[model samples]
Target chain A: MLKRLAEVLRGMGHRIIDRIWRLGSGARFFLYTLIYSGESFRRIHLTIREIYFTGVMSLLIILVSAFFVGMVLALQGYNTLQKYGSSEAIGVLVALSLVRELGPVVTALLFAGRAGTAITAEIGLMKTTEQLSAMEMMAVSPIARVVAPRFWAGVVSMPLLAALFSMVGVLGGYLVAVPVIGVDNGAFWSQMQANVDFQADIVNGVIKSVVFGVACTMIALFEGFDAPPTAEGVSRATTRTVVNSSLAVLGLDFILTSFMIVT
Target chain B: MERTTMDLWVGIFAVAGAAALFGLALKVGNLTSSSVGDTYTVTAAFENIGGLKPRAPVKSAGVVVGRVDNIQFDSKTFEAKVTLKVDKRYPFPKDTFANIYTAGLLGEQYVGLEAGGDEQPLKDGDKISHTQDAVVLEKMISQFLYNKASESDDSKKAE
Candidate 1:
C-alpha cells in the first residue's frame, strides 16, 4: 500500500516537472520566434500572405458573430432596462459591454478556434510530412519563414478584427433597438456616443485584443511546434491550441482588466 | 489563391479594419465631442464631491466646455480639490461659480460653470473659490424627513 502511494506521488512529481520543462521550452521558442521575426518583416509578402489567410478569411464569421451578439445584447438589455423606464439606455448597455469586454474576448475566442486551430494543424502537418525537417536541412530557419509571419499576422489581425466586431456590434444593436424595438434612433446613437469614451473603452478594448492576439498565436505556434510528428499528435495539438488559447485569453483578460481599472 | 488576389483581399481587410476603428471613435464614442482644444487648467475645492469622477463633463449652460481632469483629497483643509481643464476659447470669469450637478434623475455628476459678472477672465492654474458641493441624495432625503417630522410634531402641539 505504501509503495503504491509512493508510486502515485512519483507520477504527480513527474507530471509537474514535465509541465515546468515544457513551459521553459515554450518561452525559449517564443524568444526564437521574436528574434526570427525580422526576416518576416523584411520579406513583407510572407506576413501579408499570412494576414490574408488569417485576417481576411476570418472576417465573415467575426462580423456575423458580432452582429448576433449585439442583437442579443440589445434584446436582453432592453428587457432589464425597461423595468426602470430607461430603455433608451440600451444603446449604452450594448456599446459598453461590446467595447469593454465582449468584442475583444469573443473575437479572440473565435479566432483561436478558427485561425489558431488552422495554424496549429498546418504547422503540425508540415512537421508530420517532414517539410519542416526538409527546410531545416536546406539551412533555412523555419521559424523565420513560417512561424514568424503567422505570428505577426495574428498579432496584426486580432486588434483589427476586434475593432470590426465592436463597430458591427453597435450597428446591430442600433438595428434591433431603433427599427425593431421602436426605440428612438437619435437616442440610440447619442446615448452610445455620450457614454462610451474613446480612450477608456475603445482604446482599452484594442489593447486587450492585441494582448490576446499575442497570447493566442504564441500558444498555437508552441503547441504545433511541440506536437509529435504523427496524425494523432497533430489533431491533439489542434485541440490543445483552442483550449489553451481560450483559457489564456480569459485569464489574461482578468489581469489586464484589473490593471486597466486601476489606471 | 493567386498572389494578386490575396494581396487585394488583405488590402481590403486592412482598410475595412481601419475604417471600423475610425467609425467606432467618431460615431460610437465621444472622441469628437470631448476634444476641447487648448485647455486652460483651473482648480476648485469642494467640501463634498459625491460621485464626481475624473473626465466628467464640465458644462456651461448645458454645453460641455471642459472636463474634470483630477480629483484629490486635501487632508489639511478636509476638502476635495478638483482640477478642471476648460477650453481656452470659452474662458470663465474669476468669480465663476463651479457647482456640481447631476444630469438626470440618476445620471452621472458633472460640474456646472456659471459665469459671473467679473471683468477678468480666469487664467491657467487659477483657483475658483465660489464652488458648491455635490448634492447628496441621502442628506436631502433625511432633511425632508426631518422637516416632515417637525411639521407633524407642531400640528400635534397645536391640537
Candidate 2:
C-alpha cells in the first residue's frame, strides 16, 4: 500500500508539471497572437459590444449588491467604532475599504462567473458546431470575428461595472448609516468626501477593473478555443473558464495592488 | 455585408460614456491634489502610539481640522512624535492637548486635539504640551478577561 501511495504521488507530481508546461506555452501563444494581429480595430468593436452587454447590463445587479455590501460594512464598522467612542469614522472606513479593494475585485469575480462563462459556452458551442470553421472558409478570420469583440468587451466593461459598484456601495453605506445606524446623512457624506481621495480609490478601482476584463476575456477565449469538439467538452470548458477567470482576477488584483503600493 | 457608420457611432458613444463617467467619478472623489489648499503643521508626543498611522484625522470638538502627517519614535523619551497638518483657518493655542482615541471597537485610532484658551496662538513647529496615549480595545478586553478569571479563582478558594 505504501509503494502504491508513492507511485501515485510521483504520478501526480509529473501531471502537475505537465499542466504547468501547457499553461506556459498557451500564454506565449496568446501573447504572440495578440502582438502579430493587424486587425486590432475589429477586436475593439467586439470589445464595445462586450462592454455594453457585460457592463451596462450588469450595472443594476452590481449597484444593488454593492449597496447592501456597503450597508453591512457600515453597520458592522459603526458598531465596532461606537464601542471605542469613535463612531464618526464609519464613512472613512466604508469608503476606503470599498473603493480600494472590494469594489473592483468583487465585481470582476461576479462578471467572470456570469458573463465569462457565457462567452466560453457560446464560443465552445460555435467551435463544436463547426460554425467557426465555416467562418474561416467564408474568408472571415475567426480571431477577428469572434475573439476580438469578446476580448475588447471584457476590457471595456470591467471598469465601468466597478465604478457602478463603488457608487452603489457608498450609497448603500449612506442608507444604513442614516436610517439604521442613526448617523446624520450630511455628516456621513461629508466625512466620506473628506476622507476618500478620488485618485486613489476611484482610479485604482477602474484600473483593477480593466485588468480583470483582460484576464476574464483571455481565460474564456483560451478555454473555448482549446475545448475538445464534444458536448461534454464544451460544458467542461465553460466551467473551467468561469473558475479559472475568477481565480485569475483575484491573483491579478493582488499583483496590481502590490505594484500600485510600491509605485 | 458591411457594417453601417451608425453602428460604429453607437459603439464609440458607449465607450465614451463609460470613460466620461469614470472621469466624473475621479473629479467628485477629489483624488487629485490640485484642489487641496495650503497645509499647516503641528506636533504631538505620545507614550504609546497603538495603531495610529499617518493620514489619521485630527479632530477638534468632533470636527476634523487636520490630519496626522508622519510618526517617528524618540529614542530618548521612548515616545512617538506625531506631526499634524491643520487647516489655515483653524488656530490652536500653545497649551493645547492632543489625545490618541480609538474610533471604534476595532481600534482604528485618530488624534483628538483639545484647544486651550491661552492668549497666544500656536505657531508652526510648536509642540503641544499634553498628550494622551492610545487605549487599544484588545488590551482592555484582555484585562477584563484576566480580572474575570482571577475573580472566579478567588470565589473557588472561598468555597
Candidate 3:
C-alpha cells in the first residue's frame, strides 16, 4: 500500500511537470513563429493564398451564423423590450450586444471550428507524412514556410469576419423587427445610429477580434507543431486545437470585456 | 483552384468586408452625426449633476451642438464641475445658462445650453456663471411633503 501511494504521487508530479514544460514550449513556439513571420510578408503570395483558404472560404458560414444570431437577438430583445413599450430600442440592444460581445466571440468560435481545425489538420498531416522533416532537411524552416502565413491570415481575417458578422447581424435584426414585427424602419436605424458610438463600440470590437485572431491561430499552430508524428497523434492534436481555442477565446473574452468596460 | 481565381475571390472577400465595416460605421453608429468640428471648451458648475456623464450630448434648442468632455467634483464648493466641448460654429455668449435636462422619460441626461443675448461669445476655458442643478426626484418629493405639513400645521394653529 505504501509503495502504491508513493507511485501515484510520483505519477501526478510527473504529469504536472510535463504540463508546465509543454506550456513553456508553447510560449517559446509562439515567440519563434513571430520572429520568423518576416518571411510571410516578404513572400506575400503565400499569405494571400492562406487568406484565400482560411478567410474567403470561411465567409459563407460566418455570414449565415451571424444572420441567425442577429435575428434571434432581435426576436428575443423585442419580446422583452415590448413589455416596457420600448421596442424601438431593440436596434440598440441588438447592435450593442453584437458589436460589443457576440460579433468577436461567435466569429472567433466559428473561425476556430471552420478554419482552425483545417490549419491544425493540414500542418499535423504534413508532420505525420514527414514533409516538415523533409523541409527542415532541405534547409527550409516549416515555421516560416507553413506556419507564418496561416498565422497572419488568421490575424487579418478575424477582425473582418467579426465586422461582417456585426453588420449582417444588424441587417437580420432590422429585417425581423421592421417588416416582420411591424417596427418603424426609421426608428430602427436611427436608434442604432444614435446609441452605438463608432469609436467606443465598433473600434473596440475590432480590437477584440484581432486579439482573438492571434490567440486562436496560435493555439492551432502550436497544437499542430507539437503533435506526435502519428495518425492518432495528429487527430488528437486537431481535437485539442478546437477545444483549446474555444476555451481561450471565452476566457480571453471575459478578461478583455472587463478591461474594455472600465474605460 | 487557379491562383488568379483564388486571388479574385480573396479580393471580393476583402472588399465585402470593407463595405460591411463602412456600412456599420455609417448606418449603425454615430460617426457622421456627432462630428462636431473645431470645438472650444467651456466649464460650468452645478450643485447636483444627477445622471449626467461624460460624452453626453450638449444640445441648444433641441439640436446637438457639442459634447460633455469631463466631470469633476469640487470638494471646496461641494459642486460638480462639468467641462463642455462646443462646436466653434455655434458659439454661446458669456452669460449662457447651462441646464441639465433629460432627453425623455427614462432617457439619458444631457446639458442644454440656452444662449444669452450678449455681444461677447464664450471662448475656450471660459466659465458660465448661469447654471441650473439637475432635479433630484427625492429632494422634490420631500420638499412637497414638507410644504403640505407646514400648511396643515398653520391651519390647526388658526383653529
TM-score of chain B of each: 0.91, 0.71, 0.88
**Candidate 3 structure quality by residue, lDDT tens digits, A1-263:** 99999999999999999999999999999998899999667998999999999999999999999999999999999999888788888999999999999999999999999999999999999998999999999999999999999999999999999999999999899889999998988778766876898988999999999999999999999999899989999899999999999999999999998998899
Winner on TM-score between 2 and 3 is: 3
lDDT of 2 by residue, A129-244 (tens): 99999998998878777777667667767776777677677778877888877886765665566567666666777788888888887888888888898999999999998888
Q: Please give, for residues A201-258, the per-residue lDDT of candidate 1 as tens digits.
A: 9999999999999999999999999999999999999999999999999999999999
Q: After superposition, how far is residue B105 of candidate 2 from its true place, in Å?
A: 7.1
**Local accuracy of candidate 3 as per-residue lDDT tens digits, B57-112:** 88899887988889999999999999999999997888899999976566668999
Per-candidate interface C-alpha RMSD? 1.7, 4.9, 1.8
Give the interface-residue alpha carbon RMSD of model 1: 1.7
TM-score for chain B in model 3: 0.88
Runs of candidate 2 exceeding 4 Å displacement: A1-25, A36-38, A42-44, A72-97, A138-140, A186-208, A230-232, A247-263, B1-36, B44-51, B74-79, B93-108, B114-120, B125-159
Least accurate 10 contiguous residues by lDDT in model 1 chain A = A186-195
Which candidate leads the pack in lDDT? 1
Arrange candidates by DockQ, descending. Answer: 1, 3, 2
Candidate 1 lDDT over residue span B1-159, tens digit each:
899999999999999999999999999998886665789999999999999988788999988798898999999999999999999889889999999998776777899999999999999999999999999999999999999999999999999
Instruction: Provide the global lDDT of candidate 3 against the true structure.
Output: 0.92
Find the 10 residues in a row with the least total lDDT in model 3 chain B.
B29-38
| Model 3 lDDT at residue A181 | 96
Better by lDDT, candidate 2 or 1:
1
Clashing pairs in 3: none
TM-score order of candidates, best first? 1, 3, 2
